[model samples]
Target chain A: MAPPPLAALHSLGFPAKRLADLATMAGLSLWQPQAGNAGGRVKPTALRVLVLLGHAWEDQVANTWTEPYTAWIEVAALADHSILELIQRARDTSLYISFTTITANRRDLAGEVLSMIGGRRRLSRDSRDNIELALHEALSNAVLHGNLQLESLSGLSVDALERFSNNLTCRITDPDFANRRIDVICDIIGDAVTIDVVDQGNGFLPKPRPEPQASGRGFDLISVSCQSFRLLDGGRRLSMRFPA
Target chain B: MDYAIDIKEQEALVRLTGRLTFNDHAKLRALIKEMLQNAAKRQILDLANLEFVDSAGIGMLLIAREELSNLDKQFILRKAGGQVKRVLTVAQLGKLITIEE
Candidate 1:
């Protein structure tokens, strides 16, 4: 059979339930192929990517998230292999956020994300090491403290566990500054850009008066070098503002 | 907790593996000071085998050096290649810390 025309595929339509709200909260765009290739070709709008994904390819589809203008995708093609792989590959074209959320011992994920964000990703060798270290710490807390309380995602079980995954949750509080949930705001004024991170977690633990052990200090790298940092946890905020 | 620490009591050679992020700062700082106290007035620490060092690591290094300098001690740095060295350079420590070979 001849390949379906690219224009034949129409945007997905839905019953307009809480999907829209969820999308907004999660920061993502949902697209699904509608009907079969022939049905989509004829009526065009009869089937949409998100709906088709929901009905026909639920197993092939993974959770999606969005941040501001970008929707992050977690695409997995291992199960369907040949048929669905080609379909998903042809479905979209842009920056893929698949690997960003995956936490592994390898340090490539952070580097990939920094490069994707198109910011000043070039850190000194030491800073690069520090950034990865911080990332690991954050990921560890997210997985251990946050997700550890939740049930496992499907096929992602250990021991006698069996379940499909749902939304990921994070604790609102953690002692580490780098592990805090923060919104980094970048304001560019003329030739300079001011980068600020608004965190929901507590600021640095109070400095030790009796000269504490070096191994137990937290976020020492960022604390020392980041132009300025202020904690307003009493006011429910921890802000780090620096010249970017 | 997959980490290792090696300290040379005299020359300030501290080798660390695994992570040295903010969460581990308390431990890192204490280790650094401990090494400094047992070292010569001048020291060169090697971080070549360190797997990672986060913002906390950076802070400790800077603050520790300041304290050491105040005590008339010079803590030189040595051999951190790849990502770690790049991070050090970006953090402006490449100029402040002596990067030996």
Candidate 2:
């Protein structure tokens, strides 16, 4: 089948130069519904793949376009290589979202990603719960240990917990840590959907905690929840596969 | 996550609603403090309305349990259903804390 037609949309304040670069990289035609039509207007439903440059475009597309589209990409996440992969995978529904550590901390990213994918594919209740749990753990690891470089809570003591909380507050407020990028890439192939949570930080390997403790169950939960998973990029990237 | 606590003479029942994750650390800390100060000997967390929980949320629950145990108060998890219940089971939380149906 021919590749679905792709269009790029941006919100106010998004750089036109970057949009043009993205359009060139992905061979996407620009669609500015908000801008008065100099050329004939194309109906939103006609576009099969939308590359959204800002959060506002997401809301606008959701509200204005009633028909289901093949896939959508958040432009913030467009690395040169990932952009190429996204074009290749656009034939299958996929999503790429990248956000700063502060944004990830503030938003329910796992839930939002799940809801977005749920719109494209039907997920069983059990599968949905499992994916949500695994994705939540993966994102937490990315934002906390991966991006912000916060250590796992040392112990269950109130004092230890207090110190951890203080450090979390400190790191999240620091722009150096707060502005680190976290990328989530999702691709659907056949009956399985693979989601990768990638972070820019010093990578980490999970340590075994033989004793019952307050922390360190993130990996355990992820292992049990997903069909299979792997830690790549020196543990900076976690890829999880789930049944759709 | 948000909670409503009812401190009775024998037990303090805290109903936790909404999703619990690492983001709720501050709120969880405050809840732990409240549970520690309550006069009741048993602290129960009602998880029926808790729609979801992550591993970090599980750790926070462990913190609550440990803090209460240190104070010679019993910590119990009650009415965990759906995702919460499944997570509690997968984490083997029942072995560490008392869980009531």
Candidate 3:
């Protein structure tokens, strides 16, 4: 089957850069499929891009969202087939975002996800703030602890912060650690939004903080913002629900 | 995040603007250290224009409080509104530091 034309993608609300990125990332030749046939036919996964785009386009026309094409493209870059499947099942009711362990990328993804969620629904100010804070904690945990394997809440001293920052910089530059992916799946239904963040790392049990410290308060914040949360996949995954 | 320091008598007023989170750890540490060195009695964090505070930001604020306490100096957070105020309240930081409305 032929991939959708660039015009179709544009009409579907995808910007030129986003469409180009999608084509490159998915290894799809939207304009010249035969020119790239030396590498064989388009990968099946590439076709799913169309399905995903189509879903967003339909949602846009239905007035569910005005502009979701770029966001979908961003998700498509890192999302595995499972995420795509999940999104297909509930495109109008959910959002799925994933990215590598790069700190900036994680922040951008989180920011984009939060913006979309906020724009799509009319959430209370409290609910929006809580979700924003909680999701920040979750993303930080995924990058710093899960993928980078950094120590938590090292120390309150200036020296400690310096050492932590140095170590973090070194870890971020190492491909073995930085290439790992963190996935955020958010399901919004009724007055509740459930967000699940999954990382590719050996997870650890979240221990109770016995004292008020400079670090390790992430769990406390998450607990405060989320209605309920649970660890899954040996702690590699954290799922939290926020109610309106 | 951006911060401005104003030394008024023995008190140093550090006006913080924008989001404070893990990303601003280095800057926050430097700011706190500088405030401690200059402020004779108290270091007041003016968060009137601060829009966001994450858990890490809360943690950093606690760090500032702890360090100031060891110096026998006051670390006061004032004018925090909206999200910053809410996070400070949820983290129960008022028990550890002086939070002035």
Candidate 4:
């Protein structure tokens, strides 16, 4: 008998409505499993492809189904691409995500990306933690320091923090700063995974601090967490690599 | 992040849960105010349930420690496990704050 024309599109942690819309746009009939069905369990016999978006459903999908081609893609990466193209790219390429500074500030971009990647590949606990930390620093720098052009927290005082907060609020509320784009591109080849975080900023020059302070340890943490990293495009782009 | 604080005669123990990132600035600010106004001389932050933290979170913690120290008060972090523990070690935060395992 011919395989069922239905496709199983699991939202994982991604929004169900978005996934459903994507499925509709792709001209595919979707078979959504009942909500709160333990593990999002679905029989794969009638499915052509399994498209799992987001990372929240990783363990469930892993333990539930093994057959059928699965495309693990981040929902944010869905923009500007046809669903068919995305599924093909999910198999051939990796992930490319672009969002405005406002979205980056509002979402846990690093965590979502890490979870998507982790679902597709097996990352050791330590490696996952390191990647998550390094990515968090990279995204934070791209949003706050690069795109928003905000100064570092100068001192360890409530007043200083308040000033910083005020500055952040002011900048984020401004369209010129908030609307700048930040792009994250990920690629996996052999045993290495490379992620590049690019921002639309004027670029930065790293300076060495002479004293131990409360802030400015972002680069330090990123340096130790990833295997290797490079600041390109005049510091507007941070490229980091990790062991797959 | 969310926190529940227990105030005693000499110390205030705060149990912090959820992810403590830069986004928690407002809450952290409120937490700092509570720590400063309370009569307790020692502020203990329990991180046993805090699942994750970032560089900004670390900076906020430093801010708390510094503000408390200005008034001769002590700040301590205890029971940080998993990812939080690893981040603290990597950031070399132990040299600056008292972390109780």
Tell me the lDDT of model 3 at B76: 91
Stretches > 4 Å off in candidate 1:
A1-244, B1-9, B52-56
Ranking by DockQ: 2, 3, 4, 1
Tens digit of per-residue lDDT, candidate 2, span A1-244: 2323445443334678876776677776666544543222433335554544343233343442222333444445446677556555554345666567877777677877787677667899998899889998999899889988988898887788889889989999998888777777777667888999999989978998978787899998999999999999899999999877
Consecutive 10-residue window with the lowest summed lDDT within model 1 chain A: A156-165
Q: What share of the true interface contacts does candidate 4 keep?
A: 0.72
DockQ values, each candidate:
0.09, 0.82, 0.73, 0.65
The 10-residue segment with the lowest total lDDT in model 3 chain A:
A2-11
Q: Please report, in order, the local distance difference test score of every candidate based on alpha carbons.
A: 0.39, 0.77, 0.68, 0.77
lDDT of 1 by residue, A1-244 (tens): 2212222111122234434543443333544433443221433222223221222123222221111112122222212333233234333322222211122212333344333233323345444344334433333323322323233122211111111111222321222322322222333233332333222322333344343322222334345444455545442333333332
Error of 4 at A219 (Å): 1.1
Best by DockQ: 2
TM-score of each: 0.37, 0.85, 0.76, 0.76
**Candidate 2 per-residue C-alpha lDDT over B1-101 given as tens digits, one digit per residue, 9 for 90 to 100:** 99999987898999999999888888999999999998999999999999999898999999898899999999999999999999999999999999999
Better of 1 and 4 by DockQ: 4
> Which ranges of candidate 3 are over 4 A from the true structure?
A1-66, A70-93, A103-108
Candidates 2 and 3, the one with greater TM-score: 2
The reply for model 2, stretches above 4 Å from the true place, is A1-6, A15-26, A33-93
Q: What is the docking quality class of candidate 3?
A: medium
